[model samples]
Each structure stands twice: as C-alpha cells, then as structure tokens.
Target: MKMKNIRYLSGTGVAILVISVFSVACKVISPDTGELALKDAYKNKFYIGTALNERQIMGHDAAAIQVVKENFNAVVAENCMKSGMLQPVEGEFRFELADRFVEFGEQNNMHINGHTLIWHSQAPRWFFKDDQGNDVSREVLVQRMKDHIYTVVGRYKGRIHTWDVVNEAILDDGSWRKSKFYEIIGEDFVKLAFQFAHEADPGAKLMYNDFSMALPGKRKGVVAMVKKLQQQGVQIDGIGMQGHIGLQYPAIDEFEKSILAYSDLGVKVMITELDLSVLPSPWENTGADVSANFEYQQKMNPYAAGLPDSVDNVFQERYLDFFKLFLKHQEKIDRVTLWGVNDGQSWKNNWPIKGRTDYTLLFDRENRAKPVVKSIIQAAQQPHSDEKKKRKQSI
Candidate 1:
C-alpha cells in the first residue's frame, strides 16, 4: 500500500523521471484504508473520475486501463459519445465505441457519464442542414434535437448516470456563442434539449457544461440561464465547469466564486474536464473551443523533453490548492473528473496550440503516479472545517 520513491521504466526500458518534487519518499496510500487510489482517497469526499479515451475503452492500452481501474470510480467517454461520433449521417448510428465505453464503466462498477448529448462543435453537418445544404428551419432543427436526445439518452437510460445535455453554448462574455444551435434555434435550444433529455431518461442527471467558467460574465450568464431553467421547471441537475486551466490564470479565488455561484443555483457543481497545463499559452485568453487553432510554435512547446523539477513543484502546489478548494466545498460539489487518464492521451496536447507536449495530468505517459498524487491523498485525510471546529470546542 505504501508507494514510496517508485521509479518507473517505459516499455523500451527508458527510466522515467522520478516523481521527487514532493517529500523524498511520498506516500499515495490512504492513511486509514491504506489504498493507493484516487477513488479510495476521496471516496467519502466526492467522486473522483477520469475521461477514458477509445484506446483505453477498447482494451488497446492495458497500462492506462489498469491505472483507471485502480484510481477512478467514475468514467466519461472522451470522444465516442459526442453527437457526430454517435450519429454521423442522419439516422445512421454508431454505438460500437460508445457501447464499449459504457460497458467498461459498468464492468468496473464505476459511474458512467455521457460526455455530451448536444453541442455546437462536433455535431454532424446534417444536423443543421437540409437535403439541399441550406440551414434547416428552426422547427426542423427542434425536431432533430428532440430525436437525437431521445435516441441517445434512451439508449442508455438506466446505465449512464449523468449526461452533459448541453455544452459551451455561452461565451466568456455572458453572450450566446452564435453557434448553429443558437443561430437556428436561439436560446430556447438549451431548454428544449434539457426537456428532450429528461423525457428520454428521467433518472439520469443532466448538466450544462462550459469552459472559462471563472470569468464574471460567464458565471453570471450561467447563473441566469440555470435560474431560467428552474423557473420553467426544466430538469437540470448540475453545472459542469470545465476545468481546462493553466498554471497561473484563473486565480483560485476567482474560480472559487464561480463554484459558490453555481452551487447557489441549488444544483450539483462538478469540476468536469479538469486538466492543468504547465506550458505557456499563446492566447491572452483561451476557452475550450475545438475550432480555435494556432500554428505550432517551438517556443510554446518548451517542455518537450520533460517538465523540469521547478515547474513540477508549482504544478503540484496548484493541483493541491484546487483539490483543497473542492474538499472545502465537498457538500455542494458532486464530482471532479480529469479530462484524460494520463498525459500521453490528453487532448491538451493538440488543443488551442497543436503538437505541444504538455504535462497536464496526474499520471505520466509511463503510467507512473506523480508526486502530487501523494500530497493530494494526504490533503484528503485532513479533517473538514466543521470537524476541526468541533474538535477545538471539545479542547
């Protein structure tokens, strides 16, 4: 149970860097249960999960799959459940990958989360177009939305515990993104999507997920939108703040405000798609828009060789800070899911700035637990605020 000073080697027998940024011999084992797993360490606090890539789900990457089984209690499909992936050509459905993903979670006794029911990006071209390639009428789009949701949600009604029913519909400035969904159907699209999803699976938890959540404009916009959904009696269960963060931006306090704000809406606050990048960003501000792309720059890809010890210290501390915040508000938070299982398969590598080697996950490419994992486990062992107050009163 005690995993200390463990040095890992790649399949090619290259020695992976030792995770020595923490104490000389860090321990990831739970103090009480002695289980060295994220799911076990935070079992009482909240669900700790990771997004599984197709490779991991299809049994291609045995090492990553083992890491997931050992650490996470919940799994969300990385790409398979997206609208385009599921229903590429109108009525044609592709459930092979998605079916395997859900089955993997079920076999492992993990919470199965549907990545997305609807989104502007990765939606099939046919979704917003007519047979002649013109933009479909609002009425037609609405019907299409309902059909897609009902079919996808209904397919895994009782199995998928949560669905990101709508994603990134609003921009950082508290305005609608003018996406095909918004352009054709207006803001009613979100409401209708939620309604359709609820009709499909009344039991599954529905969420509105977006990025750049720490921005004041974005926070207010989501608060208002969710409030409207509540007023209209829509079945929205949670808000997923995509934690696609960097080392310095999104000050912890600013991020905390968004968490408290969303929690005030009386819905579960989930830190979904959580990943912290150690590399420098090219943009002054960046949100998780799949369309945004920048030319590959060597300057941006500085850490190609490896993340230095100095950067690792800062990275570890930042993760600890965020996890501590989640622990502080564990009552309002439902789950914290990493976007990918490990650095090797992370989407961050090709996002925004393409071909950048970013160390943006807890496990390294070699499937070794970084030193920060130990610190996080230890932090979870600390008593909650209420517990501490009671102990002080007793003293």
Candidate 2:
C-alpha cells in the first residue's frame, strides 16, 4: 500500500501501451540456470493479474494483461474510484477514468475486480468535514455513504465481477482501525456498507477485505463477524485476506488457516493486496495532506543495493512454495491479484514505505519477468503434478 506522485494532465492523457517483456528476460530453461521447481501446482486453474489505473490500463504496461493472457485468469484494478479518484468533491462525481478501465476489461474479456468501495486510507478530505470544518452528523454520513455507493456501483452494475466493498477495516490485532467513516457511521457501518453495495449491484460479488491477524482468534473474529452478517443476509459474498507479507509475521501456516476459515462460509476468498518486502525497511505513511509526497519509512529499505542475482533464484523458489500452498487449497481459493504490476510501479519503490528498490513484484524496474514469473507460470500450468506422483507410487 505505497503511492507515487502521478500527475493527471488534460488531453489524451498518457498513451498506455502494453508490451510483453517475458520472452526476452526469462528463459523457459537455461543451459546452466537453476532447475525448475514445483512440477505441478495449478493444473485446472490460472489467474495472473495486477492492479491497474487509467494510465496503466491504456498506457504501455501490457505486462499485467500479458501475464493474464499467458497465466492469470482474472484482473483487478487497484483503486478505480477510491474517495480521491471518484468523489474528490462531495456532490460531484468523476467516472471518466474508471469507465475507461472497465471498458478495457470488457474489451479484453478479462474478469474485472473493483478494489475498495470503503477504506480508512486514500479517502477524500471532504468526507469527514463540513463547510466550516465541523464533523458532519451521523445521518449525513450514512446518506453520503449510500449516495457514493449508489452512484459508483449503479454505474457499473453488471460490469464488475467482484467489489472489495470494504478494505483494511480491521487492525493488525483484529479490531476496527477507527476512521472517519467509523466515527460517523459507527460499527454498524460495516454491515450498512455491504448492504448498500448489494442493493446497488446485486450481481457483483461483495467482499470484506482486511490484513494481519491470521491467527485462530483472528480467524474466529472474521468468521464470527461474517457469520453474523450472513445471518442477517448481508450478502457478504467473500472475505479478502490482504496478503501484505514481510519476510515474516503472519507465518505461512497462519495464511492457510485464514483461507480454510473464510471458505467455510461457502463464499469466495481472494488475496487482494499482496506484496512481500524483506523488512527492517521504511514505508510511507500518509495522513491529512493528500498531496503530501514525504518519504516516511519506519525503517530502512531492504533492496538498497541491487538485489543479488542469486536472490532472484530464491525469489523464484519462494513463489513456487507460496503457489504450492495456494494450489493445495485451490478448492477454497477463488482469485489471487498482485497489489502492483512491476518494481517501478510498486509503492515499495518510493514514498513512506520504500523497500529501497524492487523488493517486491514479479517484474523488475525494466518490466522484465524474473524467475518468480517463471515459477508461478510453471505451477499454474501443472496443478497436482507432485501429488499425482506420490499417489501413483503408493498404488
């Protein structure tokens, strides 16, 4: 969840072009390169997608869709109409860019996932304040929430495949992360938000997204909350685990438990905002000033030195392991969308939470696919290959 300063000038804006950097950068096999890992991980499924904006959708960043066409089965636009992009002004709405993004997905025949109808971050300033800077009333906030959801979702009714109706609402310890929306709307706001989104786009799948707290207590909380919502018939549809992993923290096993617990609700589960960073690094933290461009990291960036070439190999192996775990639970998994596209476009590169350089993402700064790309593609093309061998030997 990092951001770079991008100016949206008038005119044809930026000419977006999509290029394939896969064939040039990564060889299917090298004469002396490391052997391929994960014989078979993703046999019957494939969904390789990255987050996209207006410039990215039309501009020359075809790496996302190229991977989709080659490997991924789904595509998610990270911030299509967050408060900043859609309702920068209270009464006014903007859809020129969001419309174009949807059109691109429709034209390309890609499954479009609309990221975030509600979030504690990246929202408009006017959302919390009145003309004289007074906090708006609860009733007013509810109306505003309904209006925004109505206008946005009503516009894209059947077009969007899934909506992250709520994002990052929970804290690392599994409690509400207190925001203006919560202040105005209260705890019930969660239920209300989903209810409104469901009313607006009945066909679009609705998901509640959060990060951290993958432990059983966390799982218990999510399951309990979603279950209550289900009991109320809120049309929750799914739960999104925002797989923002560091070198450690929500250990691999914890992630597995989350997948199983959320899927027990008989709804879909998606890895929404996914990026890994080797920590002891600083990341950007923004508040109040929307135009702020401060590099605020709690620690130093890990990839300051050029990432070692062999580390690239380690990255590929890690991808194999992660995908294998996902494939093992493929029955419960519905989609896995990368948080950003390339090293250059990732927030990990600049502002607040810089990972120094290309610490995350499938492609490097040049948009070339790395060993990670190869490992993921290989796994997706061959699901259960390893399991089959084991079963055969037993027979």
Candidate 3:
C-alpha cells in the first residue's frame, strides 16, 4: 500500500497522529521502541483466531487453515452458530455455515470454542415470545435453553473444547442481566443455563463471559457470584474478561486486580474480546459496538495518550505487559481472543469514534500480523502441530 497523507485534530497541540498506513507524511506520534517481536515468545503457547465470513473460511486451501492452526491450538467461528444468528426463526436452524467452520478446526485438530450459547443481543426475538402473541412461559424458555444447548453442544460433543455457555448474563454491577432467559425463566436463569450446557456436553468446558468485571465493584460482584454458583455445584469452568481497553480507563493496576480476583476463584480466566481502540471518547455513549456494548464499558479511560513512536511502542508494549502478567498466572489464564480478524473489521473504527477510523487489531487489512500480534505470540510459547492454514481468507 502506498503511503497516504495523514492528518488528525489538525493543529491541536495535544493532538497526536502517527504514520497510519495511508499517510505519506510522517507525524511524530510516539517514538518506536523497535519491533516488540511478540510472535516468538507466544509461539506454541496459544492460538489466535477470528470469526471469518463463509468465503474466508471455505475459500482457503489447506495451507490457509494450516498456517493458522500451526501457530495456535484453537480457532473460533465469529458468528456462524450463535443462537439468534443461526436459529433466527424457530425450527429453522441454519447449520451449513457453522458446519463448514467446525470442519476446518476438526480437520486441523484445533481446539474449537463455540463463540457463545446465549447473549441478550443477536438472538432471534421469537425466543422471548410465543405462538399466542404472548411471552413464552417459564417452562417454554427453560426448554428452549435446554434444547438449544443440547442440540448445539451435543452435536459437537467432544469436538468443541469450550462453550461460552452463558455470555454477558451478569450486568456490570455483577447482578444477572434480565435477558430473554431472565424475563421468561424469572431468576436463577444463570444457574439453569450453565446446568443445561453441562448436561448437553459434559466433555466440553463451560464459561460465563462479560466485560467490566475487571473493575473493583463489578469484579468483586463477579467473584461473589462465582462463589455462589460453585457452592451449588454449578460447572463454571472459565471467565472471559472481554479486554476492550480504550484511551485512558481502568488504570492497568485495577485491571490486574480483576485478574487476580478471578484467579483466586479457581476458575480459569481469558481476555476474550481483546481489542484496544485509539478512538475518541464519549465512547461512554456508544451503542451496539463489539467493544463498547450497551451493556459494558471500562470506567476510567483505558487508552491514555497520543500515538508517538514511544507511545505507539507503549501501546504495543502495554499489551505484552498484560500478557506477561497473564503468563505469570498462566496456570489460571486459559485463552486470549481478539474480537475480529483485523483493524478494518473492528467495531471501534466507527463506534465511539463515531465516523472516524480507529486502528486497534493485531492484524492490518492485508492479513499480515502487526507488532502487537508478534508481542502476544512471543509473551509465551508452548508446543503446537505442523498444521498450516490461513485463519482468514476470502470466501
């Protein structure tokens, strides 16, 4: 790609713009600390995956998936099989797309994590209602939850390594969010959700994921919630941290505290939605974004500062710093997932930034891993296979 002239905040003294891909003129954003070379450290220890479109998955030859599978042990379908996305209308399940996705992982012997079983958003509205133009009865809701989990999880069985069994079920305060499950099933919906998932696929790991649990208030709430569930014999296997940091929030120390707290619960933890946005603020008001959902946000601005080569260096550096902490506690850290394939697809480019573009993913549009990607891969390393496949390709 040719360098394009770049400009931002035009002339604001505090304004900072680094050398974006398109910019020809160099702007001193932050001093470069040279390449972090993270891929080496992370090699063999983990897998990085993206939810690709049908084309990106099926269009690739074995080499594509092999390329990715060799680097990590797991791959996840972005949205092919989510409840709402798959079974938008009752009894009309669309399994073709997801079917192909799993095929790739199975062929490569990669650990596949079903993106989710339940989420308030992206679900077909029908689940919350019924045939008589009334809300579904509690029994109906429970059955639906059971049926969905049983079918999906049962179908995959030993093939799927983990199911985000109950996603974002807890509100930021750590109380259960009143999703379709809550509205129809009343309460204790979280327990039932996990219970059903366990029964469906006893072999697969089960997890509850949410953002904001990395703060003191919510983190404490999550800890309390997990303890209660464990006491009842609920099979909660993991907690997804949904690492969506932004321009000045959460104070790194606070985020670390959240990790330690969860680790103490003896439940495995992961930075599920790991994306850092250099987007603007008032992000507090953004809607339906992958990073800043209507449901969660980091309290303090997480993304603090301009993009100097040094700060840009720190931006990438900070990512590894957290990873190092993650490695320090690897016994409890299970996985780290980047929300999208590359910067282009990140919801951040448009969300809180509104119309302005944001560069925040580990890979650029060309499919080459970026500095951040290398750092993550290098922070830790383990053993992997010889499989080689491109994780993302044109469908």
Candidate 4:
C-alpha cells in the first residue's frame, strides 16, 4: 500500500515545513525515486541499529551523522559508555561524550543502548585495585561493582532502553574468563551486575553480550550461564551474539544454532557489534579480543586500494545470508546493530593488525548505502514461504 497523498501548500517556506513534518511520522517515497529506508523497511520485524563513535556522536562527520539518522532506529555507543571511559578514577565520572550520545539518540527518537556496564576489557585500572595497587578483596570488589553499576545505569535511567550489563565473560572454550572481576567475585559478579542494573533502572533491558557465539563450546556455556541466572531469578533480559564474523569461519548453520539456543532461554536475542570483515584475519581463532594485535603484513592488506569485484560479490552474498537468517527468525530477534555507521569509521581497519583497509559495514566511505543495503531491505519486504502459501490459497 502507498502512503496517502498530501495537498501542497502555496509558499516555499510552508511547503518545506510540510515536508519536514511529514518526514518524521511518514516517509514520503516519491513515485520517481522509490528509495527504501532501512529502518522503515524492517519496522515491523526488528529495530535496525548502528553504533556511534565519538566523532559521529559529536557531529564531527556531518555526512555520517546524516546516514545514521536516516537509516537506523537504534543507537549504541562504540566506546564512550565503557567502564574506563565513564570512570577513569575511583570517584570521578565523565559524562561529556556519553551525554551527547544519549541526546543524539533522544533527538532522533531512537532506541538507545548502553554499550556495557561491566566488562573485563576497557575497564579502569582503579576498578580492581586497592591503594596499594593490588587486587581488592571480593567484598570490596562487590561494593565497587555496585557503586559503578548504580551510578552509570542510574544516570541513563529510562533514556537508555537497553544495557549490556555484562560482556564477553565467557571464553570460546566455555570457560569463564579469569578477569579481576571473576577472580575476586567468582560467578556471582554476573548476577550482581544484573541485579544492580535492575535496581538502577527497572525498565531497561539487561543483556549479556559476547563474541564468537557460533562456537559450540561458547554457545553451551552461554546457555548454561543464562539458565543458571534465570533459575536464581536474576533480571537478565537478553543475549547479544556479537556478529564479528569473517568469510570462512562461523558456518551459517552454526550461527543459526546459537541463535536458537539463546532464544530458548525465553529472552530477546540481539545481534550486537555486528561487522563482517572483508580482509583476512591474523589468527585462526581471534575471537574479537580487543587486546589481540599482530604485526602488519603486506599480504594481509590485499584490498588496500579497494575491494575487488569478485570479493565484493562474496561480501554482498555473505551479508544477504545473515539478513535472510535474521528475517527467518525475526520473532526471536529484537535488534540487529551494525558496529559502525560506515566503512571508513569501522574498527576492523585497525584491529588485530594495524592499517589494513576493511569494508565491513553497510555504508561506504562516502556515507552512501552499499548495494547490500537494498538487498537486505528487499529480503525483509519479501513475503515468507508461509505467507506466500496463504496468498496462493486466498487467490
């Protein structure tokens, strides 16, 4: 069905006003130019989201900011909301960038998400230390955890709709990471983080976010962990399967299995920090570890100038496959957030190995939607097999 017609106003000023007002509540798709907005295309199924870096949030890149506002309905902080950035010292809190981030989301009427409340990496050194610079006792750590969670989550309150309460606590092999939080507080750290976040904001959705979720070991570990939390009545709301994928790894079926397993826990499933790297990975098992870095190799940077047509074809197909899976199980998934707004800003370019060009996101360097954007929108708009069957029967 088409959008209803609107009569034109006389003056240019009045006509521009009408267009601006209609733009928010209704997207006027011109007959000549059938532009498909990503957020509008998938409005019924799930939220289309993107992460905002400091530059983008601060409006340093006006072109990228326009792309974000036009396409995505949800926003997550790329790094500003992390523990270290939010609180570098014991009692000090920095909300400069974070405040702007929340404001941007609010102005756009976006579903705002807090990147993390508790994370092993990108955490302040003071978070786990005593005055002597040794790890604090479990009791002290517990108190600190509560203070941090309450302060951060409390600040956002109802403004941020979702919080990654805990992130990457489980390793690829199903073992719990022995980060300072885990060493001092044991498994209850996850539980306590969830509890404190809930206390701060009862309305916000609390999520466990992780990468390499396609691994069987990690999948089992997450399912077991979430189940234990549920049994204890922790208010965990969702699981975020980080879509930091490459071309060869994470066979489609394995990814689907993880999605189904997480969905079975009766919680919303979110695809978070999602980016598909077109460049080769440095290691066979580099599972999105921020600390993992390797020396640059000439061979590693194949597409330094630009992605080849042959490789671009595969890249487009890979994105389509993931979107198809998302559309197939749209009922179980709540949100799908790209890790960055455009290829130029994507972290993949400088990760694992430095100075390698990567085409990872849906938008190109110029902030124009890539070919796959239309493919994804079209895939979402197409009727499902069941829907097609019903239509045939009706006819």
Candidate 5:
C-alpha cells in the first residue's frame, strides 16, 4: 500500500508541473495571438494606418504585408505616389507602382491617402525649368501643376479617400519656404492646387500637410492658409500634422494645443508620418528634408547595436502618452498612421546620418509587435484618466 501511494503522488506532481508549463507558454504568446488588432481597437474612434513601401505594395514582404492587412484599416504609399517616383520626367507619368498601391488598398478595403500632389522637394528639374534650363514661366508652372494634379487625382478618383494636396508649404517662422512653386506662381499656388484637385475629384477629401505644425508660429501659419483657402471657396477638408517627433521636442501640451487649433477651423486633423526617433539629433532643430545631412559621429548613433532596455522603456512610454492624447481628441482626429510598417524599414535609419540603425516604430526588426502595441490598445479600450476626472467633476 505504501509503494502504491508513493507512485500515485509522483504522477500527480508531474501532471501539475506540465499544467504550469503550458500556462506559462500561453501567457508568453497571448499578447499577439493575432486576436487584438490595432484597427479593431480603435474601430469606432478613427482609422489606424501604416505607410507601405514598394516591397509591400508588390507583395514582396509577406510578413510586413500581413501586419499591414491585419492591423491597419488605411494605407498610404510612402514614395511610390510622390512626384519624383510617379512622374520623374516631364509630361510622362508612370502609374504601374501607384496602381498596384491603390489596388492593394482596395483589396483590403483600407482608406487610401494620396501622399502629395505638390511639394518643393522630390520634384524633377523639368517641372520648374524649360528645355534651356531657365525657370519656367508662371503660366507654364501653373499648367504643369494643374496637369499633374488632375492626372493623378483623376486616375484614383472615388478610390482615394484623402490627399495631401499641398505639403510643407508653411515654414517654422510663419513664412513660406520660397520654393519654385511659391517663387514662380506666388502664394496663390496653394489655392490653385486645391482648385484643380477639387475639379479632378470633388468627392475626395483634400488636406494641407506639414511637419512641425505643433509649433505656435507654424500652427498659426497653417490656420491662416486654411482660412485663405476657405475664403477663396476652395474645398480643404483636413490638415495632416506630420508627426516626425523626437524624445523631448514638441511637448504634449503643445501638440494638444495644435489639435485644438486645427479642429477649431472645422477641418479633420490627421497624425501623419508618426515616428519617434530614439537617436540624438545633429542640429538644434531640423526639418524632414531628405537632403538634410549631418556629420556622422559615434555619439549620434549610440544605439547602432540595439536599443537598450532603459531607452526602449522611455520610448514606449512616450508613445503611450501620445496615443492617450489622440484618444482624448478622437472626435477631431481622423487617422493615426505609423510612418512605416516596422523599425527595420523606417526612413529614420538613413536620414540625417546614413547607415544608422534607429528603432522608431511600434514593430521591431523581427516584425513582432512591441509592448507599446498593448499599451495603445489599452488606451483605446479604457477612458483616459483625464476624461474620468472630467466626468466626476461634472457630476
């Protein structure tokens, strides 16, 4: 009887150990069992989106593509839809890549946003000059702008839900960048761009997109521009605040102020190109110009090997704070799009300092959702603490 009892006790112990091991495994894989999707988390609030690179559009990056389809409800072409890639030459347009991009969005029933119709940078030399390399006449530039806007917007008419009709037009100090568009066609170029886009696709939502819009002067300039468009009877529907943020610039209060400022204009606000760079900045202040380069230094790219846990913890917290603010103002905001699908594919890796590994996205290089993914979902699931306080105060 003693021997039988000893064997029974040993079997029970093994069974309990097996059950514990299985429970631990379940907890490890529970976060992203593909059960909680970002889009669904904010379904009634606003669209969750990510920009697609060429590889994603062509179905080359299967893992990235799956994440996009499963988590995002809207899509924007990162570069393929831009002027440099779409119409590199004069009067000749390439639509193969852009077409595939649109098709991909349609297949997934995602909201499609045309990145930019007119911008100072990334435009071919032929756009602003004649055959003899002289600056094109005002009439010539206007015609070129109209043709490009009509062709692009018209092709994707009724499909593209919104467009960055004019990008980065306002400078940080409440002045225009004096690009060839502003130099030749004057400030009214923005008005014309909006009119032409409206004519091409009257139903599509047109937006003016820019970075550093959270700054006071830049926010004022954008508000003035939108007002000017409205007075001219132009159909400007939204403002895309390009959220190329850093660790400590543009305080949360400043960002929230801009959201209120833009929303006061009665236009939908979008958080476009959202990425937070963990590396050090080369200059005191910089714009998102790809041509903006800085001297490479070891200190600049400290995380060249990998992000330390300490830095990553701060990064995740910053993202959580921003998403919480976004949820609080979901009524005015229309969408929040991560700049890229994963950290491995982020533009921050090459900008300012080339050949640097920077982790500026929600997904890590392995294409796995980072801890911030759970935080954002939780933010969406529960009322913000501020909201709870407001409710109690009202009572």
Candidate 6:
C-alpha cells in the first residue's frame, strides 16, 4: 500500500489524517481490500501475536477480540498469568482468569505464550517471607519455586506452546538483579526455573526474557547465562528481547546486533512485549518497569487528548522500520508480539506515569488499524535488496 501526499495534523486529528491517507493511498489491489490481517501477511515468515488482557480474554471487548482473531496467530496473557495475579497466596493457585486466557488462545487456534513463570516483579509477598516475615531459606525458596512452576506449567501443558521461563533477571550493566530468587536461591535460580518448566511440560519451548537486551552489557550477560544453561543441558529454546521501545532509543543497529548475537547461540529470538511509546520519558534510560514511578506532569503527558500528527507519523515510521528489520532477519526471529491489542489497552498509559494517554500500538483507541499496519505488510511482502547487499559487504 502506498500513501500519497500525506499531510501532518495534531492531536486527535492524527487518526483522521491516517484514515484519509489510507483511503487514498491504499490503492494497490490485493486479495483483501477492507482490513489486512497481519497474521495472513506474515504467515510464511513468523508468528504475529498480541498480549491479551482480561477484557479480551473474558470476552468483554468484542471488537478487540475480533481484531485479535483477524490479525494475530499467537497470544500471551498481559497480566492474568503473572505470579501476583495467578497465585497471590502460598500454596494457593488462581487459575480462573488464566484458564480463560488459555481457552481463548485455544479457541482462536493461536500459539500461546505463558507471560512468565518467574520474575523479580509481580511475585506475591509471601513467596519470600517465612511465617515470622523473615526471608525464607534457600531450600524453602527453591521448593516454592518448584511447586509454582510445576502447578502452572503442568495445568496448561499441551495448550501453551511457549513459556517465558524467567523474565528480566539480568540488569542492563551485565549483572544479576537482586530479586528474592537470586538473593536466596543464588544465580542458579534461572537454571532451576527452566528445568522445572521443562520437567512440567517437556513439549513447551522455554525462553529467558529481558528488557534492554540491545545494550551491550545486558546482551553479554544474557548470552553468558544462556551458554551456561546450554552447558548444563537446561533445555532453553529461545531468548525474548522485550521490544518495549520509543522513537529514539534502541537504535536499529543495536537491536539487530542483539538478534544476531542471540541467534548465534542456536536459540530462537522472539521480539516479545513489543510496543513503541510515543510519550516523553521522565528519565533518559527508563525502561518498561512496572514498579518504577514518576511524578505526573502535564508536559510529560502532552498527548492526553490525542497524539500530534507529526508524532503519529514518527510512530508509524518507527514500527515500519522495526518490522523491516525483523523481516530482514526473519530466519533468526520466531515471533513478534505486540504488548497489547490497541492504544486504549496499552500498559504504557499507566506505567511509570499514571493516567497518561499513549499512542504506542498498531491499532488506535477506536480499534482501527493504523496506516503503519499496511506499511508493515508491504515491507514483509517486498524484498530487501539493499539489506542483502549490506550483509554481503559486511561479510
């Protein structure tokens, strides 16, 4: 699809401008003239997925579900599968919401990814403390980890195809985070998490997920961890580079380097938790930390009403560029999952800064596919001779 003579507008007018441009520019005749499904476009390359929230899982958001069914072939629970939400108390599991999420994926015939089996954040408070509120012993913590993984992984063994066995364990400076799992169980907790996940459901692909993977230090740390797991026969299948990005950060070259680095380890690379936030960051190096908080400022939340057309153009181009890079390295990349379905449901709205409107997804607040969707499809369908030449020159 080609957009011609596009004009930039501001605020809520961005969507209107996009729709008008698409109406005129999307003239290339293809099988579908109405709405192009992303899954169909990238079916041959890799799985296209989105993270589903309770609204979509419980069938409350019919339009979002419809969009999900049409565009995505894989699904991951956004918050339902997290430890805090899944099992809030010791020895107790809450499978009602998660079960519904898995069923939704099954009903749609989509590849299901368990958002996380273990993580530093979102874990229940009781998981680390003993009866007296002191830190649990190594043995007790290890046992707790085992039980949690076994129950969660075993319940949806065949239905879930992939599991984020461990999430965000390494910090950006090539060091381990001082999470309870690390403090008590030591560095081996990651290996144990993968092992328990593998034992519970041997068929599911186990992955180590983290943000800032493109940073040299974090990438090296993750690579070392993966190699160690491989040496120990831990059965790790992939690495999830959380693609929570913005307009300026994580340059394309750096992202490509991380992908190639992980792929070199003979593991599939998944662009997980993918979202491009258009809002300004409070700090220079802030990432997608759910726990990180920032004072709300009106200037920071500039697009509360709507994203400026210029910002919308930047968002579209940024997504197109990343998709182009993914397509260029499709052989190494197994899946690319949007963090959420649409702008309205994005975690960016409340993360780091509360009540900020963020235009960080492919679909707008109204569930209409942005003009960038067509651009991505076109990028996937077309060949990249320029990239091929660059690769040859580098070789």
Candidate with the greatest TM-score versus the true structure: 4
Per-residue CA lDDT of model 4 for 27-97, tens digit only, reads 74422115668888888999999999999888998988888887889999999999999999888999999
Candidate with more favorable, higher lDDT: 1 or 2: 1
Give the higher-lDDT candidate: 2 or 6.
6
Q: Residue 110 of model 4: what lDDT?
A: 97
Ranked candidates, highest TM-score first: 4, 1, 5, 6, 2, 3
The 10-residue segment of model 4 with minimum total lDDT is 1-10
Best by lDDT: 4
Candidate 6: RMSD to truth: 9.0
Which stretches of candidate 2 lie above 4 Å from their native place? Answer: 1-43, 60-71, 213-217, 282-299, 381-395
Cand. 5 TM to true fold: 0.90
TM-score of each: 0.91, 0.80, 0.76, 0.93, 0.90, 0.89
Quote the RMSD, in angstroms, for model 5: 7.1
lDDT values for all models: 0.89, 0.68, 0.67, 0.91, 0.90, 0.89
For model 1, the superposed segments whose C-alpha errors exceed 4 Å read 1-35, 390-395
Instruction: Sum up the clashes in candidate 3.
Output: 47
Question: What residue pairs clash in candidate 4, if any at all?
Answer: none
lDDT of 2 by residue, 187-256 (tens): 7788999999989988998998876637566577778778878888789887888766655445778788
**Candidate 6 per-residue C-alpha lDDT over 292-388 given as tens digits, one digit per residue, 9 for 90 to 100:** 8988899889988777889888888999999989998898889999999999899999988898999889998889888888888877777676657
Q: Per-residue CA lDDT of candidate 1, range 166-258, in tens?
A: 999988899888999999999999999999999999999999999999999999999999999899999899999999999997889999999
lDDT of each residue in 1-395, candidate 3, tens digit only: 22333332455422344345323353211122133233224433444444455555675544334335434456777778789877888878888888888888888676688978877778788887877778888888888877887888887888888888777766666666766677777657788888988988888888888876666767877888889899999999888888777646557788888888888888888778777766445736412234453323443234333245755675677666777766665556778777766666676655653444556776655555667655555445432221112223322
Instruction: Give RMSD to native, each candidate.
Output: 7.6, 11.0, 13.7, 3.9, 7.1, 9.0
In candidate 5 the C-alpha lDDT for residue 252 amounts to: 91
When 3 and 6 are scored with TM-score, the better candidate is 6
